[model samples]
Target: MKKLKILILLLTAAISVSAQGFEHFVTAKGNQLMDGDEPMRFFSWNIPNLNYVEDEMEFGRTNPYDLPTEFEMRDAFETVKRMGGTVIRIYTIPVRNTDFPEDAVTFVEAPGEFNEEAFKVNDMMLALANEYEIRIIFSLLNNWPWMGGRPNYAAFRGKDKDEFWTDKQLIKDFKKTVEFTVNRTNTITGVKYKDDKSILCWETGNELESPYSWTKEIAAYVKRLDKNHLFMDGFFAIDGRTTVMRESLADPNIDIVSSHHYEPNPIKMMKHIDNNLRVVKGQKPYIVGEFGFASTKGMEAVMQKIMAEKDIVGGLTWSIRYHHRDGGFYHHSEPLGNGIYKSFHYPGFHSGLVYDEKDFLDMYRRYAFEIRGMEAGVDEAPNAPKLLEIVESHDIRWQGSAGASGYHVQRSESAEGPWEVIGYNVSDAAIQTFANFHDESAELGKSYYYQVLATNQGGESEPSNVVGPVVYEYQALVDNWVNYGKAFDSKDIELVTGDDRSFKEITSRAKGKKGSEMLYHVEGELVGFKVYAFEENPDTSSLKIEISGDGERWNEADTQTEVYASKEKNYAYQVPKFYQVSEGENIRYIRISFQDVAQIARVELLYK
Candidate 1:
């Protein structure tokens, strides 16, 4: 027993050291690869591990019992090949043991047994990849709702199960999993799989950084694994520049920079792209690993323009499976079922490329098909906006719409690049009227570029002037606030006046919920105060409030006045109401709250 234990320990140590020694280098042609080869542009389906198999099985009509079967993988790979896809992305972390209860492999700890079912499935997948000439980008770490450990006795965990950055048990489980994958040569029908040219890359994790710390540990660990495949990590570029990219690239183990872009406007999406490119500075290769096109307008043209550029490798849309839980919209082919695929419960997410009998291939053809390549270089010159045209300005607005939601304008002096967020349409003027804003502060004699984007109910509109880069130097920062999700409730307005004694900043309270209130602090003199309520909707019924001076002497705003509907027939009240100052003037503190019990929508404030 002691000799056997020593052998196992030595083997484990050998695996860890083997994983850490490899270094990544670029090919002469500038493609980012593990062994310095061109990455074959491919499309892949993200198959969840044993734990998530049930969700996919039940909702997506996949049969996990036959998952490792040769015929099943061959059929799946063939289908993908028919759709022009060249790769498959398989998940390694199983979410819940229940997702595959009948299966022999389990992440849960039982005794001294090991469940090698995951390894078996992976072997089948690799065989399929070899058969179909499709590459595989396997994710190593456990993702989302699953914890990791041993077989029948593994430590299965997710982000919530353990602190992603500091969980020791989870880390150890991952290290073991990697060792198992690297040391074991996969077998499909008695054939060994290793050092195969068909395996494209080894991805570190899928969609990491819900808070941004997971990447550091996971990236480092992956570097300690097999050196044969290029290491990639997934990231979402939502706000700010690529702060996360800078941190990830600092570790030498990371081979290529990858990110997901989903902005409404082509120009806006390009902003993220440009920002990422600037940070990378071409030291390594970069790719927009994941980007999506809703049945919308902007991205098609944007993609067409990008297809003409050489630096970009390619991007994977969302999921490749024609399943319902993921809103199965078929991009490359038509749906196989008629009334066969329908959401049994929540139906809001319709993100699939093919939907019931519909031939949605045109959508894919419109963007991905006709793409060609061109050299990459920026020309620095007139830094001003061109074709600065407004597509559609609307009187009404809603969240996530092209003409209805919001607008954004950007300016850059170099024209070659480095565009800055000059202004956004969230300003009081832009919200009220979709008008052009001219930044008089723009310095003369220097070139500038500018572009305007409109967002309405569907999403942001395609940026108007995408043909040429726009230039602008003069700009201003607009001050405004918006209702984030829901209208303010009565409890939110009335609860504040009771006993709180400090001059509290109301921004935190108003966050997430929508309503209007005075933004500037009223610090000086106060002879009278009024709450301006806008009767924007008909459902509003009541209002609530609280007042305080010196953080004491709390008095509630008149509940009667707050409860009244709009002076108009609608429940909303846009007019302001005057309230007499109960204290002897020189009011240093004022807190008035308003909530519409009936159908509160928009509110404002008027004070003197």
Candidate 2:
């Protein structure tokens, strides 16, 4: 009788724990994703910066990849919630590359060595997902070398990239990564990652071009370590192939299959989705893990097909970037689109006009709610913006609110008290690289505390963090490229416009090639001037600046300009050089000559 009672108690305890585990996780049920007992479907986004950031393009910052702060993580989650999204597929966890700077941060520092600090950020990401009731599809590795990927893993053993799949030593090193990630405990929640409900699935890698043999072994390994979460095969070819391998479909360990669609043709994209749906019919749930960079109509057509198909569980847009903790949105000009479309932000902005970002996001929000069989009600007021820095009266920057359309700048004599409105209805979207509002009305010599309130169609957010005691120093003439001819005289300069970090507007910059020169007519007693230049290669590019009292006689300004060259070659590098003039130099005209292709974003001339 005693033995019988003990056996029954043990069985009941195991059942209870199993039941609790299934309550929150997303499970696969033969072509359907189940949330508890109901089917789960969503139209969502891919947030690449959810864990690690690669777009930290702040001025003078050498290294780009850093662990995102809690503020940044929360902002991304909140943006997804506002967009009516339930799931967000984050980019792959970073691995350290041999060529990376010694100080560069990566999640997998070595074969079995994980960075605790990097993983802590990931823990916070999962914790936020749980708090926000959002599900995450965490990718484990990368096939591309954007952040360290398969090549880096192979390099560790001094083997070729192809060996990562077939080599025994390389496979062992990868499995160790899998085991560590699956069994690691979340510092905040004190729950193992395998048991966390916030994770929707664990993708093998980001758009990996892995062979079937490697995926099968890795998928089984992941399932062995994690029985609660579903495993997704991340094998994909960039050539717009939509069908999953038969080997992947037959594997018991692979619970979900996905395909990436970048086909610009709407009919082709839909046809591809249908082909995958037919292939995975009744075997496992299928998802369009990533898709976009098509026309608004084309993307809408793809979304319609995903929603209409019973077997297609969900689809995430190519990507969405959120507000950076330091201030402004993390910008990535998608090279695939020829640098025309940047990653979409919540509620959209004019910066993404070429890609129909505003219209597409609206469509995404509507579809995101519709697919879930729910109505998207009125959006709430945006969260408060963070006041990042007050460079000067003319150069004010802040971290943008997710859904905010514009901002109102207020000034106060003291930190806490009666404030005066200095600037109203200022658009942060007018500029790229940073969210800026020039306080032109700020009087010289008057030191005042400043705060900003973000506004949108929904409502206004609370005041941003206070930046104070800023004394207006000089009356400055700032040209940000919009009115190019008004500030500088150069016909050889071409006005290049699009979603590029090099071009700043509200004033846009001038693009100059070799033998091109621009002359700026200085209106005031020139104190000093700072030139913001974007050079592709500083080693080969040179810009000469000379001052002339008379239009004929010119003297070169004796100043050395140091521009930090980044290792990443995809984006344009900003080289901001400041030249100081002695107190009483009668300078009338400033001439700038470009020796190589370069973009001059802005020129700030400081004067009394």
Q: Which candidate number has the best TM-score?
A: 2
Clashing pairs in model 2, backbone N/Cα/C closer than 3 A: 480-507, 480-508, 481-507, 481-508, 482-507, 482-508
List, residue by residue over 1-608, the lDDT tens digit for candidate 2. Answer: 99999998898656434423235688888889999899999999898878988877665566667888888888898889999999999888788886665678998888999899999998898888887888999899889777788998998888899888899999999888888888988787766789888899999998888899999999988998989999998988333554777688899999998988887777888877777767777688988898887889888888888888888899998789877665667777676864555788778777677788888888889999999999887678887888866867777888778778778889998999598988787766666654477776667788889999998888999998898888876767777776665566785888766545543211256788888988777666677776777776656546888888776898887655767666554345465433344433887677788878887777777765
Model 2 — which ten-residue stretch has the worst lDDT? 499-508
Error of 2 at 522 (Å): 4.8
Task: Assess the local accuracy of residue 240 in candidate 2 as a C-alpha lDDT between 0 and 100.
Answer: 50
Estimate, for each residue in 480-579, the C-alpha lDDT of model 1 and write its tens digit: 2333332222233321110000101011122112342222224434333333232324345333445444545756544333322222211111222213
- Models 1 onward score TM values of 0.45, 0.91
Report lDDT per candidate. 0.40, 0.79
Candidate 2 runs further than 4 Å off: 1-23, 237-242, 389-391, 413-418, 485-488, 498-508, 521-524, 548-553, 569-588
